[model samples]
Target: MPEEMKTLVVTGLRTQFNTAKGPVAAVRDVNLKVARGEIVGLVGESGSGKSVTGLSIMGLIDAPGEITAGAILLNGEDLRKASPKRLRELRGDRIAMIFQDPMMTLNPVLRIDTQMIEAIRVHDHKVGRQEARERCRDALGLVGIPSPEERLEAYPHEFSGGMRQRVAIAIAMLNRPDIIIADEPTTALDVTIQSQILAQMQKLCRDTGTALIWITHDLTVVAGLTDRVYVMYAGDVVEEAPVEDLLDRPIHPYTDGLIRSIPSHNAPGQPLNQIPGITPALDRMPAGCRFHPRCPRRTDACLEEIALRSFGPAREARCIHPLVEG
Candidate 1:
């Protein structure tokens, strides 16, 4: 793919926050790229900085949390240097984010239609209210909402949790943004609902050629949904490859441990293969590789900082002695 065709590219991205203890590295230097019509998954456990990386790309990190270094290029535009006003202009129109909580995007007291039309008008004032309403209704139906016209007339509280999330997703798709960073949007839904939403999202990306970044800790979700997966540990991308490659032949020890730890990998009577030790706290990340303390395959070389290097064609890992040697 040509450079100009890339939808999103993040290089040396680092995010940190100020706390009473000290500056905590929430997201260490990381890099990835997504092309038009591609689906990428940022897979990691909680506090592994999956969401923070998404927020950094969206320019949503606030207050003490800031992007200390790196470049976030959306469609070849450097967002790191974009003005606040320019960022606002790009938001919702060229780039949109679907938050984990639906309420964060929806107003409690406002009617759904009121909010949806307002969202459209914010970027396109020339769109008449009635025209915008039709677009909103179309978007809601696209997400499988029943009687979208009537649903639009009701308040957010009137909808169930699954339905509310669907609405949130519809809002993200309203403008057909170039890229969407979904922060575990389906994590709250039941498996059935999650599958349906995932299918819809996949179809949306295909039909519109819009790139997508699905951030979640659930390997199961990434297994079937994503084309490529990036496994993060201690705020850094420890492994990245095609989804099947990462799952069937994980290069990094942490990635191998995560795949082995999945419930489906265990037999009925067998105990799960959980990775030992908790993820190190941000403020107390171990020297060298952040995951070295918890890594079962640790070696003397692992105690020093390592950079992501090629493990094979189209695959990379941060460990000095990765399981899948070249």
Candidate 2:
């Protein structure tokens, strides 16, 4: 790797759920690399293992759902083999995750100041209470919270939905973690708030050189927020490329369908093109190419297992019949 490339490498990542029927492969043979200060978008439909992949990276997967095989490397260090104590030290200090639901990270019973102060103290125990309180207030200001001192004394429920989400984002930023895995942190907010939050996050990441993994089902969101995009389906990555390249010249059929499904480009009265068929259940994955059943350009060869191959400089696709310009 080059001096500028501080890569977070993930190879052969496989997460399986132990069910009564059999093992359910939620994520299979997934490989990805997020370099320093790079924002990588992981886009997929519901139950497509996007969130599971993020959780696995953060070492938050519970029993019954386990990362069966994989190497999660952060700046060349393998996090998978790290001890629980080491992982605990890393979480919220070196790696933080902002979930879709603000409540998931926020304690409803505690005031915002209490939660944020505790977070600051966890990483910087030598700081006095007043200093921690000031740091908490500054973190809140960084996320665009108005009247930070007053807001800190309020409960989580006191804030509006969008405000609560912003506060959650503020908490994630309190530690200035090197990597922040945001799993649709703005999905619940209105358009205005979403845009504001996205802008703030982008600016913060750029200024601080924080690598981000933003997982969402919205192509539009990814287009606006990420430097690159990775499309996943049936627990496998179907396409990966620069954001502009992936959006403008998507190689995989699934990627094309997703681009076409976005309603923003449709005419005043034209119906948006919607990709039919739900993602296959984990235990019921199709024989060869998991996406063949739903692909428009699928052929008999698509019924054979197709591994991801290089398509361009820093771009890859797993489709046998990838689209190419004549």
Task: Give me the candidate number with maximum TM-score.
Answer: 1
Q: Write the per-residue lDDT of candidate 2 for residues 263-285, one digit (tens) a residue.
A: 77677679888777878888889
The weakest ten consecutive residues by lDDT in model 2 span 1-10
Which of the numbered candidates is closest to the native, going by highest lDDT?
Answer: 1
Cα TM-score of candidate 1: 0.98
Alpha carbon lDDT of each predicted model? 0.91, 0.89
| Per-residue lDDT value at 75 in model 2 | 73
Show where candidate 1 strays beyond 4 Å.
none
Clashes of each: 1, 0
TM-scores for the candidates: 0.98, 0.96
